[model samples]
Target: MKTSDEPIVIEECYAISQEKVWRSITDVREMRLWFFATINSFVPEIGFKTEFLVKVEDRNYTHCWEVLEVVPNEKITYTWSYAEYSGDAFVTFELSKKENQTRLKLSLTVIEDFPSDIPEFSRESCIAGWNYFLGERLKEYLEG
Candidate 1:
């Protein structure tokens, strides 16, 4: 297991079934609607390659990640990397099913050997960002 000294975890609870939540997480078309502005290609199968393009502050941030593991309706894990930053990330999404509703827990661990001159990436910003992207965006999108 890879744990980060600089931790990043964001969990979002959904008032929905586990199957619906799983579809929201993995269904490429629905995902592109909420998560990524443009996910060029996505397949949940392990070893699949994917890239996403998102615009923030009028700037385009290209996401380069790979599907690493998939436990059907249970969890999805992936590795993320960015060219600008010299770091790798393992993002895991764990789902807990309920009779009436389900909850999704997301944990992202980032490893960065950032130069001292460069500022450390703000975990606060990252957390809030995911909150908006996954919680507000995806969750709301699914509820509707």
Candidate 2:
């Protein structure tokens, strides 16, 4: 599904255990190790919110995520928006077991209402970035 200017949609699957992968994501300590530069806090409960200071291109940006849905180590959904920009986007993490390995899929949807300031919200870039983060950084962190 296309959202305004976001032409690309990313679909990436990671191989890991549900419990292990869930920790990598919802656990604040584990998230700071691979996901964020500095995470303020991580509360997995639904409706709970958290913010983090992320550095992209040498610029520190404050991003906030509101937990939308949580199903233990099975799935988690949230809406993310950066203070430096506008528009709220949805991100969903789905976990499934496959041959004793957890198959994790992350889906990001750029809300139809694109960010006003950050007009460079290209879905293709988002896809590639997530691929490196979830598929690479998180993967390597878990493997190690």
lDDT of the candidates, in the order given = 0.75, 0.75
Task: Give one clash count per candidate, in the order shown.
Answer: 0, 0
| Model 1 lDDT per residue over 8-113, tens place | 6777777888888888888888787898758777778999988766656655556788999999999999987665555677889889975567878888886554
Looking at model 1, report the run of 10 residues with the lowest lDDT sum.
112-121
How many residue pairs of model 1 clash at the backbone? 0
Q: Tens digit of lDDT per residue, candidate 2, span 1-144? A: 235554333444456677988888899989889988588888889999987776767565678899999999988989877776666788888878877677777777767465444424555556777888877888789875
| Clashing pairs for predicted structure model 2, backbone only | none
Candidate no. 1 TM-score: 0.84
Full-model lDDT, candidate 2: 0.75
